[model samples]
Target: MSSSPIATVKRELLVRHLEAWAPAALHRARRVIYAHGYADADGGVSAEAAMRVLAEQSDLVRGRELIMVATGDDLGAIDPRLKTISAESGAGAGLAVHTISGGTDGRLPVGLKAVGAQRVPVLGFLDASGSEPPAPATVAALTAGKPSEMLLVLPPGSSASSVDAYRAGWPLFTQVELADSEEPGELLVYATTAGKSLEGFKEALWSVDEFAGVRYRDPGDPERHLIDISLTPHPGPLRRELLAHLAQAGEATVTELRTFALTETVYRAADATRVLHTLVDAGTVTRRPSHGRLGGDVVISA
Candidate 1:
């Protein structure tokens, strides 16, 4: 009757990055407004994550706020706790949740003028089930600078077939695809207007054993039908925290580490693995049963 644990797990993965990205983003601007409030049937995980982010980064987000946008008339779909936090947060000021009559049709519920009124970097996110993503204008302002970012969650479908739509929605930002048709029913596609492709995200996952069964691709890459997102991008603090988690848990299989990270921290198995080989090179960790570049048995160094 409920969504699969894997679905929740993956959604949380997105949320953790948002939490991680918040403070760093704030450094570039005086205020930050993070928006997400669509397709939140499973307890509004994204909305809750934003609230948790506000709670976690109290010092940096004093004047900054997290704006959550939800559309449609399905009151039952809305999470009551979001309202509770909103009421207690800033009386609809900071951490305000706005309910609109239409979906995230490529514009903030408050309109671009309202968003520009803040005069700060903006990060917009939408998880839509339909073929239509946020209209280009909804995300246009954020694309001008690298600091501004937009994330789109596409339901399972022909990812490559709709590459045109993704390219159109994101404007100049590189259209980085995060999934394919393999996991048909899973929350299977991610397109981000990020400075770098999620190569690090993919590589980090590849370095772990649990993700061996996972295959992420793009229609345009050398893999043709399956896009190879193999690149070594920096994972930042995610790598540090993941290593700490592994160290605390001791030498374990990749699957074991993945389960630990998923339950205990914001860093997922993939995002945290960006620094795995780096640590092995620096002796922060030692590869046992030496599997070379494949990322086999790992042991934390003393």
Candidate 2:
């Protein structure tokens, strides 16, 4: 991919957008369940999102192991990109299209079935254009007791209640995120079982010159930060990177640090607080008084 500032920010947005979630959703994914209204030219937006996830995971996967399940009716007849992406020798995957019907609220998508049976980790990308968003029971049934996550794109002005219900049913995760994009007028909802990155997702797109001006939602919560960075190989340097941001900013909220990691640094929002706590632990930085062990603003030591 091109390293242009916008492209770079977008890619980081996509990755950290996901990185705040489960490990299975990215590096260790075994299957990808893609559901969309119909296959569009050039494989459609669903394919593009799935491709981004696969590309993000390419460096981690060895040999062809990941399996992709999509709708059969339209999928088999159009767009070969998914087929090509699945057939690669190393990081590519294998494709399976399940017979799926469209344009109804009650009709169940076959992709949901693929997600349920898998014992391996999964990344479910659902585009709710052809049909209404899956019911909460549906999402819960597919993700129950498994390390799984889903990214959904629904029609604009979608019912907050419906999205809420869809999120409420999932047993694995408690956070339900809603994001807006201008071009599509689409509502993007990301729900994961492990972590949160709403702040980071918003940060990746807004940029000025060399600075990708993405900010964190909350910087005071260290516990959440710990959960986010645990997925990465080295938490130490990532933490330092967060500290450096704090040093530059003088003193910032926990959410600000999370934002920095999501866009400015090659780290997740969780990484910001993890390093802040480390600095506080070492007596190198001072934190606001009485915000609990993991909560409070932080200042770089003089």
Q: Candidate 2 versus the native: TM-score? A: 0.49
- List candidate 2 stretches off by more than 4 Å: 1-45, 52-64, 88-119, 129-131, 171-185, 196-302
Tens digits of per-residue lDDT for model 2, 1-302: 23333333333444554444323444445454434333342244445455545544555555424444454235444446655544452353333433344422233334555445454455555555334555665455446424555555556456557666776644332221122222223444555454443343334323212324222212222322221112343565456556666667777767666656654443456656677777777877777762476653543342
The best candidate by lDDT is: 1
Q: What's the lDDT for all of these models?
A: 0.49, 0.46
RMSD of each: 11.7, 10.4
Lowest lDDT 10-residue stretch of candidate 2: 174-183
| Candidate 1 Cα misplacement greater than 4 A, ranges | 37-43, 72-79, 86-94, 106-112, 117-119, 130-146, 159-161, 168-215, 221-302
Give candidate 2's error at residue 135 in angstroms: 3.5
